[model samples]
Target chain A: MTKNILIAGFGGQGVLFTGKFIAYGALIEGKELSWLPSYGPEMRGGTCNCSVIVSDEPVGSPIVNEPDVLIAMNRPSLDKFEDAVVPGGDIYIDSSLVDREVRRTDVNVHYIPATRLSTERGFDGIANMILLGSVIKGSGVIKEETIPAAMSKVVSAKRQNLFDFNIRALALGAEVLE
Target chain B: MAEKVLMKGNEAIAEAAIAAGCRHYFGYPITPQTEIAAYMAKRMPKIGGVFLQAESEVSAVNMVIGAASAGVRVMTSSSSPGISLKSEGLSYMAGCDLPALIVNVQRGGPGLGGIQPSQSDYFQATRGGGHGDYHMLVLAPNSVQEMAQLTIQGFALAEKYRMPCMLLADGTMGQMMEPVELPDSAPEMAEKPWALTGTGLSRKHNIINSLSLTPDELERWNIDRYARYAKVEADEVMYEEYLTEDADVCVVGYGIAARVARNAVNAARAKGIKAGMFRPITLWPFPKAALNKLATTCRAFISVELSMGQLIEDVELAIRCSRPVTLCNRTGGMIPSPEQVLASIEEAAAKLN
Candidate 1:
């Protein structure tokens, strides 16, 4: 089976890093993966995204037309990619801020309060990672334990303390569905 | 290389330059590429390399040209407007046959357009933005690894032909990060004996000037320059051909757009559409021969670019051997999606069949 994932949101929302964690996790898991980012001026204060394709065979392409797993961290991201999820694919939205609801029978939609959960867990500005937890829990694309390891590696070496909160946030989001 | 460190593209180029034996760098900082200047600023002094953040891009290029003329491996870089400012210096470098590397991390253009990644500089780069009949050996790199590799090759080729070599990168290739395995350092490679470091009292003073008083001498100089360009065209042209063996359609592109086009070609093949991609790594002295050979089997060609059909002109000229080359592009801070390219290829293919 092939899985395509797109993590997109505004510039500082950590959307790029969110996708990085997933891609790196998949790579570390010995899965064939490709990660590509949205280039140009769109990278600053604009919507930034990275598309990842993971397959058992060599990935035919890295670009994704219809992502199997979509993680939307903001309203614009939710509105833009809500319809892009492939039929029977799943989606994880930041329920804390996204007010609108999506109805699609073929795709399973999970509304998780990523921001609130992150805030409650003392992980501010990490709503993207919180949203990542929701997607992983919903999709089981990677082992829950490996996600934290990936997060720690991405957190800037200077901000080593920040990994504490991101790990806590991921665990909180994982337990919420249980 | 360097013990397997994670680095951004800009930093990688700086490291690659040093590894390539470049001890001289002069540039000013611009957004999306500031890290390159920053990397040089920190690393150059420690390694005994000369790093100068010039007053402006114009000053930077001239400094590089001067140092390079003195037989030093020198370089300078900037974005769109900055590169535009360096045109005068580039023309001088080409005219004087100075060996150097000039990097243009392309951003939007036509007047400080924007800080977005754009391949719109194809004309400026390949057609000689400066006022001259000379061409800079343009190398387009699609990935971070290629960015480093090409920078080193750019310096080497510059010395080989005694001409200015350009690294035509965009903001995407500059700011993006990826794992890169760097090649061996410069000393490991062969050395140049033509360097003007010193001629000694045994011989007359060496003068590296573009000016010639005699009309006949100047005419002969231009002819000599073209001869070198012809040799470059024959020896240095490089490209990548993928899945074009039995393909009915050929998609031509380079740099980031080329990477995207490759993915789209794979996607089209999965959908039962016979598609292939020809990515020209060298823009000037373009890999025309390769494309011409591939044209024998392909019925039609698709020109994929990020500009308004800039490289399309070149592809049409190259593939004039057999088929028509259609264009698929997105301009002014836009990147054409792979699906869009596939649709264009399919549409163009439908016309012939």
Candidate 2:
């Protein structure tokens, strides 16, 4: 089945990087994928988002009109994209930033305090990865085992010391629900 | 030994150009296409290739002409407005019969338009953006993978015809990322016998001049160039046909618009409407004959684009209005959704009845 995923947050929230990691995981699993960002001026502030498609077949459109999974890292992102999730799809809301309840009944909603938990653990900049960890567990779109290697490939060598932190963040995210 | 790695479309084009033996890149920075220049700036130096950022788009195109005349594979990239600035240099390159690759990662257009994805440059790209009676072999890539593949093809075609070739992508294709298998080695470059590499005393000097003092001589040059363009048209038409067999409506588009149209075609089919898509991979050669052939079978045609019916005109001309040709388009940087295209397809299907 094809999975249309949308990840959105502020400009510095690693919205694009979160999408890239999932895209890389999809690639590692030999799935066809496309990652298209909200480019130009719209990428400046809290409205930044990216559309990702992971499919067994070739993707028709990189732009996701109604996503199967919506990862909203902020209140504005959740408000803007929550309704666009497909019926019976999944929506992950970063509860620390988004206090509003999900208004949809047809889909599953997981509210994780990604920012609060990450900051408590002293991993300030990788709340997106923590949310991504929940996304992997919540959606089952990709295997959890595939993420570390994908993260290794995506993170540059200069930042290699943060590799363990990112991996730990992913594990912490996965434990949010369990 | 092809290695698959995820890369943004602009970076893939830069790497693919290097793999195609392109040793020189000259371009000014522009939104949506700046990544191409950025990638070249970072990688070209390490590979011993020349990557010079010109003061303006005009100078960049002129630098391409200069480098290409020296018999090296050279390229430059820009967006819609910058492309307009480079038009004069493009016409000059065409007149001189130099080989160069020009990539237009098109954004909204006319003059200083927004940096959103747009196909507004369709007319400017295919119908000779530059002055004079010259044509550029325009390759339209819909995906990041095609962005890499077509850059290689663009360089080869430019060398083969001794003419400038364009990789006509848009902001969507430029910024998107996908897993692409890069070529293991640079393709073998064609020898340039008439190149203006220094003439040793043993050989006669070759002049690279577009200025023909005599009108008759210029006319002769134009005629010869037209003949070569005709050969390119006959041999290099590229397109992709999806579910065209026994379809009542054929949707035609290219670049990112084509990808959106493909989804519309599938959605239309799901609703029991006979729909298909004809994607022009080569926008200049246009795959007109293939489209014309489909017009005989399909009940009608819908030209989908991110411009105000730029490609539709060519679609009508190609089919000679034999089929009812209609347009489903969005202009000024708006991308039409699959539902929007489906509405048009359904409208076109209803018109047939």
Best by lDDT: 2
Tens digits of lDDT, candidate 1, B91-174: 999888888888888887679788877899999999888996799999998877788999999988888888888899887677
TM-score of 2: 0.98
Could you estimate the TM-score for every candidate? 0.90, 0.98
Q: Score the docking of each candidate (DockQ).
A: 0.30, 0.89
Query: Candidate 2 on A42-141: residue-level lDDT in tens?
Result: 6446479999999999998899989999999999898898889999999998999998999989998999999999889998989998998999987888
Point out the worst 10-residue segment of candidate 1 chain B by lDDT: B187-196
- Candidate 1 local accuracy as lDDT? 0.81
How far does residue B248 in candidate 2 sit from its true spot (Å)?
Answer: 1.1
TM-score of candidate 1 against the unseen true structure? 0.90
> Root-mean-square deviation of each candidate, in angstroms?
3.0, 1.2
